[model samples]
Structure formats: structure tokens, C-alpha cells
Target: MHTGDVTARLAELLLGARCPGCGAPGMGACAACAAGLRRMQPFGVGGLPDGLPPVTAAGAYADTLRAVLLAAKERNALGLLPLLGGRLAAAVARLVLDAGGIPSLVLVPVPSASAQVAARGVDLTTSIARTAAARLRSAGLAVEVLRGLVLARRPEDQAGLTRIQRLANRAGAFRAVGPPPSGPVVVVDDIVTTGATLAEAVRACEVGDRQVIGAAVVAATMRGGGAR
Candidate 1:
């Protein structure tokens, strides 16, 4: 098993398998948080303010969800990514099904800057996408992970950047290493703040034999607030 699995099991044992966001002890998601998150309907984006693929987010980017996302992405709390990524993957899978049919899902994680991944001791989004792929496979879906894509530039952090600025910064920053494997490619990210990053990733993958299908993220900051 991967480190994510080990951490997830440990978290479940220590936290009573509770929803990390709301402190609902005893289940992966408590009724309240689940209801709230679910209420943040999976909205379609032409792309984030950035230029990523159409994104489907599990929840908004604040409050309980924010805490969970920070823990997973910033604090080296790897366990939460599986929980969060799995939810996003499920939502994405639904969209795939609704669109027509399920193609072999190839998870292409949006690459983080090498410096940031080095600081974190791992590629956060890649790891989360891997876990999500595993979960999707376990549910009897065909899936695989491809990290053949690489970054050609390191754009500045997008925290306060406007959508246009973010898009301009990320333009042409990604490049594919080789021909993509045969399947529908879905770019995965931990969060879709503006979407500049994800869009570039999708564009890079489209250069090869890959069919760009969609994108998914654990959370997205709503224009107004919260996920809903």
C-alpha cells in the first residue's frame, strides 16, 4: 500500500473515522458536512478564471472544507486528500457517466512547481490524484495515472491573482513528455482557485493521443463565498 493508505488507516483509527472538516467523529463524512458539501452543487466551469478544463468541484473553498484542504495540502496531512479527492472523483465520474459513457479514465494530476513539491516532500496533487484513481478502480471502473506531463515554467503563486493574470501567468507553462495513453484524460487538482493552472495542464495533454475529457478538484472557491 502507498503512504496515503497507511495514513488514511491511521487517521481513521485515531479520529474514529470522522469527517475531518466538521469534527463529526465516526464517519468519513458526517451528515451536516456532507449535506453542506453536497449542497454546493457540482457546477460546470468553462474553465476556472484561469484556463483549465471545465471543472467540477466537490465543495466551495472555505470554512470546514478549507481547513481540511489546508491540512492535506500544506500541513503534510496526506490522509485527507484521499477523502477529499475521492469525493471529487465520484462527482467527476458522475459527470462522465451522464455525458454518455465511461471511457478509461486517465488521471493527469496538475503538476506543482518542483520547489513546492520538494518543500512538501511529495507532489500533493499527484498523490491525491493517485488515491482518487485507486478509489475509482476499486469501484469497478477502469482507471490509471499518468505523470508524463512536465512543467516548462514556474508561475507565481495564484493566491490573490485575478483570473486574467492567472491565465497569462500559466500560459504555455506545461509540456507533455510523450504520446498520451489511449483514454479520456481528466486533470486533477486539489483546488481550483482561478483555474489558470488546470487549463494549461489540459492544453498540454491535448498535444498527444489523449482525448481531453474534463477536470476535477477537491474544492473551489465560490465567487460569492463557500461552495454553494
Candidate 2:
């Protein structure tokens, strides 16, 4: 097969011709699913999940948005990158423009715990952040991604934990891998559940005189497990 043919076949195999939202089998989510996903209003700084900074979510973490995020983060749905990536970039842009107050910005993704990375075989949050940063750069914005943060100590997953519980679990968990960057740094993540993880990450990023600009995420759990 020619290169173009091979590429097309790969796209078909990866993205399929159906929608993930409705199982209609044509380029993933169908029009209804797409519309449902869009109904999730993008929200700004409020009660965010742990290990993040002042954050924004593209939509509530339910229904189509939840499905898309799980598919991307757990099921290895690389095809959804363009969709989720666009949202992530939009969140980053909003933070940089409003909360961070920095013209040129740097994106720093909160490092997934080592065990989680080993399980997934990919850093989903970091991947999304890199994609988002590229989109920002394409729009003539100065942006760079620096994966210079890591969990100082491994901890339990915050899945069922309360916000306070999550906060305690993630407190003092992150540390810089080296001297941090000079430009404003926005901590990026895939979701905000209880604002605990994001808070811990913000504290770590702000340590050592590094200016933590803000936080951004693709989604946030809404009205679930006490998420505001």
C-alpha cells in the first residue's frame, strides 16, 4: 500500500468510523454526543480538586465528558486527543489571560504517581498538556512545557476520598525535579475531583520562589462526592 493508504487505514483503525458517545461507529461521538459534550460550560476558579492551582474545567465530569476522559486516560483513546486537547488548551489560555497574569506562560503538568504511570504505560496528563502547549504556540503565544515535577512520595489514589481526605493524602507529595523554570508556570491536569491534588501541587510548585501562575484541567467532577 502507498503511504497515504497506510496512514488512512491506521486512522480508521485508531479512530474508527463510529462515535464513542453513542456507539454509532463513525469518527467517535455522534452529533448528539458532541452537543452533549459542548453543553458542559467551561468554568473557572472555584473549588478545584487536589494538587492543582487556581483551575478551570472545560466541562463537568459526567456523561459524555466523563466517558471521553476515561477513554483518553485509561483506555488509551489517542484519537480523542484533538477533542480533549483543544479543551485543555482553552483552559490554559483562560488561566494565562485571567489568573496567571503572565503574557508568556509555561505549562507544568503534575506528575502522575509512579505506580499510575507504570500501570497506564503513558502519561496522559502530560501528553494532553504538551498537546495543549503546542496549540497555544500555534496561536502565536509563547508557551513551553516543562515536566520538572514529580511525586516526592507515592500515595493512595484519591478516587473515593473526601476533599479533606484527598487533601491530606496529597499534601507534600510533589517536588521539583530540578531548579524550577523562571516563566510563569501553570500546573495542568486531566481532571479536578476535590481540589486536594491541585492544592498540593500548587503548594509544591510555588515553593522555592517559583511563580506558579495557575492551574488548568480538561474536566472537573460536578456535584459528585462533594465537588463544587
* RMSD to truth, every model: 6.0, 4.5
User: Which ten contiguous residues of candidate 1 have the minimum total lDDT?
Assistant: 45-54
lDDT of each: 0.71, 0.74
- Tens-place lDDT per residue, model 1, 1-228, is 876556656777886565657765443545576566556656565334433345677666778778777766676666566667666776577657766878577888877788889888889888887877888888788998889688898777666777778778888998988776887888777777666777788888887557877888777777732111
The alpha-carbon lDDT assigned to residue 72 of candidate 1 equals 68
Give the lowest summed-lDDT range of ten residues in model 2: 219-228
With candidate 1 superimposed using the best TM-score fit, by how many Å does residue 5's alpha carbon deviate from the native? Answer: 22
Q: Which residue pairs collide in model 1, if any?
A: 50-194, 50-196, 51-199, 52-198, 52-199, 60-227
Best-performing candidate as measured by lDDT = 2
